[model samples]
Target: MKSSPIGGDEHPRPLIREVVVINKQGIHARPAALFVKTATKFRADIGIEKEGEVVNGKSIIGLLMLAAGEGTKLTLTAQGQDAEKALAELSKLFEDKFSED
Candidate 1:
Protein backbone atom coordinates (compact mmCIF):
# COMPACT_ATOMS: atom_id res chain seq x y z
CA MET A 1 0.00 0.00 0.00
CA LYS A 2 3.06 2.26 0.09
CA SER A 3 3.47 4.46 -3.00
CA SER A 4 6.84 6.12 -2.54
CA PRO A 5 8.74 7.61 -5.43
CA ILE A 6 11.99 5.82 -6.10
CA GLY A 7 14.93 6.36 -8.49
CA GLY A 8 15.40 9.79 -6.94
CA ASP A 9 13.42 12.87 -7.92
CA GLU A 10 14.46 12.67 -11.54
CA HIS A 11 12.39 9.58 -12.24
CA PRO A 12 8.96 8.69 -11.03
CA ARG A 13 9.12 5.48 -9.05
CA PRO A 14 6.46 2.89 -9.64
CA LEU A 15 3.63 2.67 -7.15
CA ILE A 16 3.55 -0.77 -5.60
CA ARG A 17 0.69 -2.57 -3.93
CA GLU A 18 0.13 -6.04 -2.53
CA VAL A 19 -3.25 -7.59 -3.17
CA VAL A 20 -4.76 -11.02 -2.65
CA VAL A 21 -7.04 -12.76 -5.15
CA ILE A 22 -10.31 -13.38 -3.37
CA ASN A 23 -12.59 -14.56 -6.15
CA LYS A 24 -13.78 -18.13 -6.01
CA GLN A 25 -12.32 -18.86 -9.42
CA GLY A 26 -9.21 -16.77 -8.98
CA ILE A 27 -7.76 -15.14 -12.10
CA HIS A 28 -8.99 -17.23 -14.95
CA ALA A 29 -9.64 -16.09 -18.50
CA ARG A 30 -12.65 -13.97 -17.64
CA PRO A 31 -10.99 -12.26 -14.73
CA ALA A 32 -7.76 -11.81 -16.62
CA ALA A 33 -9.65 -10.20 -19.48
CA LEU A 34 -11.42 -7.94 -17.04
CA PHE A 35 -8.14 -6.98 -15.45
CA VAL A 36 -6.48 -6.26 -18.76
CA LYS A 37 -9.44 -4.23 -19.91
CA THR A 38 -9.31 -2.10 -16.80
CA ALA A 39 -5.56 -1.76 -16.94
CA THR A 40 -5.63 -0.60 -20.54
CA LYS A 41 -7.79 2.34 -19.57
CA PHE A 42 -4.85 4.01 -17.85
CA ARG A 43 -1.69 5.40 -19.33
CA ALA A 44 0.52 3.98 -16.60
CA ASP A 45 2.74 1.02 -17.20
CA ILE A 46 1.31 -1.80 -15.17
CA GLY A 47 3.13 -4.84 -13.88
CA ILE A 48 1.80 -7.69 -11.84
CA GLU A 49 4.19 -9.82 -9.83
CA LYS A 50 3.70 -13.14 -8.16
CA GLU A 51 6.57 -14.61 -6.18
CA GLY A 52 9.40 -13.41 -8.42
CA GLU A 53 7.74 -13.37 -11.82
CA VAL A 54 6.55 -10.05 -13.16
CA VAL A 55 4.33 -9.56 -16.18
CA ASN A 56 2.68 -6.71 -17.97
CA GLY A 57 -0.67 -6.05 -16.38
CA LYS A 58 -2.27 -5.03 -19.65
CA SER A 59 -1.51 -8.38 -21.22
CA ILE A 60 -4.16 -10.98 -20.65
CA ILE A 61 -1.80 -13.79 -21.52
CA GLY A 62 0.69 -12.53 -18.98
CA LEU A 63 -1.94 -12.49 -16.29
CA LEU A 64 -3.09 -16.01 -17.08
CA MET A 65 0.45 -17.26 -17.03
CA LEU A 66 0.72 -16.36 -13.38
CA ALA A 67 -1.84 -19.07 -12.51
CA ALA A 68 -2.81 -17.04 -9.49
CA GLY A 69 -5.51 -18.70 -7.47
CA GLU A 70 -7.66 -17.76 -4.56
CA GLY A 71 -5.63 -16.48 -1.63
CA THR A 72 -2.67 -15.88 -3.90
CA LYS A 73 -0.84 -12.67 -3.17
CA LEU A 74 0.22 -10.49 -6.07
CA THR A 75 2.19 -7.31 -6.30
CA LEU A 76 0.95 -4.55 -8.58
CA THR A 77 3.38 -1.93 -9.87
CA ALA A 78 2.50 1.05 -12.00
CA GLN A 79 4.63 3.89 -13.32
CA GLY A 80 3.32 6.92 -15.17
CA GLN A 81 1.33 10.06 -14.63
CA ASP A 82 -1.69 8.06 -13.47
CA ALA A 83 0.24 5.41 -11.61
CA GLU A 84 -1.46 5.98 -8.29
CA LYS A 85 -4.91 5.95 -9.79
CA ALA A 86 -4.12 2.85 -11.80
CA LEU A 87 -2.93 1.00 -8.73
CA ALA A 88 -5.97 2.07 -6.79
CA GLU A 89 -8.37 0.77 -9.44
CA LEU A 90 -6.45 -2.43 -10.02
CA SER A 91 -6.23 -3.21 -6.34
CA LYS A 92 -9.91 -2.50 -5.98
CA LEU A 93 -10.58 -5.23 -8.56
CA PHE A 94 -8.76 -7.71 -6.35
CA GLU A 95 -10.48 -6.42 -3.22
CA ASP A 96 -13.82 -6.74 -4.92
CA LYS A 97 -13.09 -10.32 -5.97
CA PHE A 98 -13.27 -9.35 -9.62
CA SER A 99 -16.98 -8.82 -9.06
CA GLU A 100 -17.53 -12.53 -8.73
CA ASP A 101 -19.28 -14.52 -6.08
Candidate 2:
Protein backbone atom coordinates (compact mmCIF):
# COMPACT_ATOMS: atom_id res chain seq x y z
CA MET A 1 0.00 0.00 0.00
CA LYS A 2 1.60 3.17 -1.16
CA SER A 3 0.29 5.94 1.03
CA SER A 4 0.54 9.62 0.22
CA PRO A 5 2.25 11.30 3.08
CA ILE A 6 -0.20 12.74 5.60
CA GLY A 7 1.79 15.91 6.24
CA GLY A 8 4.46 15.99 3.60
CA ASP A 9 3.90 18.04 0.48
CA GLU A 10 3.96 14.74 -1.39
CA HIS A 11 0.99 13.61 -3.42
CA PRO A 12 -1.38 16.31 -4.58
CA ARG A 13 -4.08 14.73 -2.41
CA PRO A 14 -3.53 12.86 0.86
CA LEU A 15 -5.62 10.75 3.23
CA ILE A 16 -4.00 8.95 6.12
CA ARG A 17 -4.78 7.94 9.69
CA GLU A 18 -3.36 5.68 12.38
CA VAL A 19 -5.34 2.78 13.86
CA VAL A 20 -4.54 0.08 16.37
CA VAL A 21 -5.28 -3.61 15.98
CA ILE A 22 -7.84 -4.38 18.64
CA ASN A 23 -8.13 -8.01 17.54
CA LYS A 24 -6.38 -10.32 19.95
CA GLN A 25 -4.70 -12.20 17.09
CA GLY A 26 -3.64 -9.12 15.21
CA ILE A 27 -3.73 -9.09 11.38
CA HIS A 28 -3.76 -12.81 10.77
CA ALA A 29 -5.10 -14.49 7.65
CA ARG A 30 -8.73 -14.53 8.71
CA PRO A 31 -8.82 -10.95 9.93
CA ALA A 32 -6.75 -9.89 6.99
CA ALA A 33 -9.28 -11.46 4.69
CA LEU A 34 -12.06 -9.62 6.44
CA PHE A 35 -10.14 -6.38 6.25
CA VAL A 36 -9.55 -6.89 2.54
CA LYS A 37 -13.18 -7.68 1.95
CA THR A 38 -14.24 -4.50 3.66
CA ALA A 39 -11.58 -2.48 1.97
CA THR A 40 -12.67 -3.62 -1.47
CA LYS A 41 -16.13 -2.27 -0.73
CA PHE A 42 -14.82 1.26 -1.10
CA ARG A 43 -13.94 2.84 -4.39
CA ALA A 44 -10.85 4.44 -2.92
CA ASP A 45 -7.53 2.71 -2.75
CA ILE A 46 -6.65 1.20 0.62
CA GLY A 47 -3.28 0.55 2.19
CA ILE A 48 -1.84 -0.42 5.56
CA GLU A 49 1.43 0.52 7.20
CA LYS A 50 3.41 -0.95 10.06
CA GLU A 51 6.90 -0.39 11.36
CA GLY A 52 7.45 2.09 8.54
CA GLU A 53 6.58 -0.43 5.81
CA VAL A 54 3.39 -0.28 3.83
CA VAL A 55 1.40 -2.79 1.80
CA ASN A 56 -1.90 -3.18 0.08
CA GLY A 57 -4.73 -3.75 2.52
CA LYS A 58 -6.59 -5.77 -0.05
CA SER A 59 -3.69 -8.09 -0.54
CA ILE A 60 -3.67 -11.04 1.82
CA ILE A 61 -0.03 -11.92 1.21
CA GLY A 62 1.09 -8.34 1.61
CA LEU A 63 -0.85 -7.85 4.80
CA LEU A 64 0.46 -11.10 6.22
CA MET A 65 4.00 -10.03 5.52
CA LEU A 66 3.45 -7.08 7.76
CA ALA A 67 3.73 -9.56 10.67
CA ALA A 68 1.58 -7.29 12.73
CA GLY A 69 0.69 -8.46 16.22
CA GLU A 70 -2.23 -7.70 18.47
CA GLY A 71 -2.30 -4.06 19.50
CA THR A 72 0.35 -3.28 16.96
CA LYS A 73 -0.15 0.18 15.59
CA LEU A 74 -0.84 0.68 11.92
CA THR A 75 -1.57 3.50 9.60
CA LEU A 76 -4.38 3.27 7.10
CA THR A 77 -4.64 5.46 4.06
CA ALA A 78 -6.90 5.88 1.10
CA GLN A 79 -7.13 8.08 -1.93
CA GLY A 80 -10.10 8.92 -4.14
CA GLN A 81 -13.64 10.12 -3.70
CA ASP A 82 -14.51 8.03 -0.63
CA ALA A 83 -11.10 8.27 0.94
CA GLU A 84 -12.24 10.00 4.10
CA LYS A 85 -15.23 7.81 4.82
CA ALA A 86 -13.39 4.67 3.89
CA LEU A 87 -10.60 5.48 6.25
CA ALA A 88 -13.02 6.30 9.02
CA GLU A 89 -15.08 3.14 8.69
CA LEU A 90 -12.02 0.98 8.33
CA SER A 91 -10.51 2.51 11.45
CA LYS A 92 -13.75 1.83 13.22
CA LEU A 93 -13.54 -1.80 12.14
CA PHE A 94 -10.21 -2.00 13.91
CA GLU A 95 -11.59 -0.29 16.96
CA ASP A 96 -14.46 -2.75 16.97
CA LYS A 97 -12.00 -5.59 16.99
CA PHE A 98 -13.08 -6.96 13.63
CA SER A 99 -16.69 -7.23 14.61
CA GLU A 100 -16.01 -9.51 17.57
CA ASP A 101 -18.77 -7.42 19.10
Candidate 3:
Protein backbone atom coordinates (compact mmCIF):
# COMPACT_ATOMS: atom_id res chain seq x y z
CA MET A 1 0.00 0.00 0.00
CA LYS A 2 1.34 3.39 -0.95
CA SER A 3 1.29 6.51 1.17
CA SER A 4 0.21 9.77 -0.42
CA PRO A 5 0.79 8.34 -3.85
CA ILE A 6 -1.20 10.83 -5.81
CA GLY A 7 0.21 14.31 -5.82
CA GLY A 8 1.69 17.08 -8.06
CA ASP A 9 -1.77 18.07 -9.18
CA GLU A 10 -3.02 21.55 -8.54
CA HIS A 11 -6.50 20.48 -7.62
CA PRO A 12 -8.28 21.41 -4.45
CA ARG A 13 -8.68 18.82 -1.76
CA PRO A 14 -11.62 18.20 0.52
CA LEU A 15 -10.79 17.66 4.15
CA ILE A 16 -12.78 15.04 6.01
CA ARG A 17 -14.26 16.23 9.22
CA GLU A 18 -13.00 14.37 12.26
CA VAL A 19 -14.52 10.87 12.33
CA VAL A 20 -14.25 8.85 15.48
CA VAL A 21 -14.06 5.08 15.19
CA ILE A 22 -16.76 4.08 17.63
CA ASN A 23 -16.50 0.42 16.69
CA LYS A 24 -15.26 -1.59 19.63
CA GLN A 25 -12.46 -3.37 17.76
CA GLY A 26 -11.31 -0.48 15.64
CA ILE A 27 -9.98 -1.15 12.11
CA HIS A 28 -9.08 -4.78 11.58
CA ALA A 29 -8.38 -6.67 8.38
CA ARG A 30 -12.04 -7.05 7.47
CA PRO A 31 -12.89 -3.43 8.13
CA ALA A 32 -9.71 -2.23 6.50
CA ALA A 33 -10.57 -4.08 3.33
CA LEU A 34 -14.06 -2.67 3.43
CA PHE A 35 -12.77 0.84 3.86
CA VAL A 36 -10.43 0.52 0.90
CA LYS A 37 -13.21 -0.96 -1.17
CA THR A 38 -15.35 2.08 -0.51
CA ALA A 39 -12.49 4.43 -1.26
CA THR A 40 -11.87 2.88 -4.66
CA LYS A 41 -15.35 3.67 -5.89
CA PHE A 42 -14.45 7.24 -6.75
CA ARG A 43 -11.72 8.86 -8.79
CA ALA A 44 -9.92 10.88 -6.20
CA ASP A 45 -6.81 10.77 -4.06
CA ILE A 46 -7.85 9.87 -0.53
CA GLY A 47 -5.67 9.95 2.57
CA ILE A 48 -6.18 9.05 6.24
CA GLU A 49 -4.11 10.69 8.92
CA LYS A 50 -3.10 9.19 12.26
CA GLU A 51 -0.38 10.26 14.66
CA GLY A 52 0.98 12.68 12.10
CA GLU A 53 1.36 9.99 9.45
CA VAL A 54 -0.76 10.21 6.34
CA VAL A 55 -1.56 7.00 4.57
CA ASN A 56 -3.29 6.33 1.35
CA GLY A 57 -6.89 5.92 2.36
CA LYS A 58 -7.43 3.29 -0.35
CA SER A 59 -4.76 0.91 0.77
CA ILE A 60 -5.55 -1.89 3.20
CA ILE A 61 -2.07 -2.02 4.68
CA GLY A 62 -1.97 1.72 5.13
CA LEU A 63 -5.34 1.80 6.83
CA LEU A 64 -4.53 -1.06 9.14
CA MET A 65 -1.42 0.70 10.36
CA LEU A 66 -3.52 3.62 11.35
CA ALA A 67 -4.45 1.53 14.39
CA ALA A 68 -7.55 3.51 14.75
CA GLY A 69 -8.66 2.10 18.04
CA GLU A 70 -12.12 2.78 19.30
CA GLY A 71 -12.68 6.50 19.77
CA THR A 72 -9.57 7.30 17.73
CA LYS A 73 -10.06 10.37 15.67
CA LEU A 74 -9.14 10.26 11.97
CA THR A 75 -8.88 12.93 9.42
CA LEU A 76 -9.68 11.93 5.84
CA THR A 77 -8.68 14.01 2.88
CA ALA A 78 -9.63 13.65 -0.77
CA GLN A 79 -8.28 15.76 -3.57
CA GLY A 80 -9.10 15.41 -7.23
CA GLN A 81 -11.80 16.14 -9.71
CA ASP A 82 -14.35 14.21 -7.69
CA ALA A 83 -12.97 14.89 -4.27
CA GLU A 84 -16.26 15.99 -2.75
CA LYS A 85 -18.07 12.81 -3.63
CA ALA A 86 -15.18 10.58 -2.66
CA LEU A 87 -14.71 12.23 0.71
CA ALA A 88 -18.43 11.97 1.40
CA GLU A 89 -18.51 8.28 0.61
CA LEU A 90 -15.42 7.53 2.65
CA SER A 91 -16.75 9.46 5.60
CA LYS A 92 -20.07 7.63 5.34
CA LEU A 93 -18.28 4.30 5.52
CA PHE A 94 -16.47 5.31 8.71
CA GLU A 95 -19.72 6.62 10.12
CA ASP A 96 -21.14 3.14 9.55
CA LYS A 97 -18.42 1.54 11.61
CA PHE A 98 -17.07 -0.23 8.52
CA SER A 99 -20.31 -2.23 8.53
CA GLU A 100 -19.18 -4.34 11.43
CA ASP A 101 -21.69 -6.77 12.92
Candidate achieving the largest lDDT: 1
Candidate 2: regions farther than 4 A off: 1-12
lDDT of each: 0.91, 0.82, 0.80
- Candidate 2 achieves a global lDDT of 0.82
Query: How far out, in Å, is residue 43 in model 2?
Result: 1.6
Q: State which candidate has the highest TM-score.
A: 1
Q: Give me the runs in candidate 3 sitting further than 4 Å from their true place.
A: 1-10
TM-score versus the correct structure, for each prediction:
0.88, 0.82, 0.82
lDDT of 2 by residue, 1-101 (tens): 54445543333365999988877888887778888888899878888989889898778899889988887999998987667888988898888888663
Q: How close is candidate 2 to the true structure, as a TM-score?
A: 0.82
- Cα deviation of 82 in candidate 3 (Å)? 1.3
Local error of candidate 1 at 51, Å? 0.5
Clashes of each: 0, 2, 0
lDDT per residue (tens digit) for residues 9-97 in model 3 = 45664656567887888998888898899889877788999868999988998988888888888888887766778877777877888
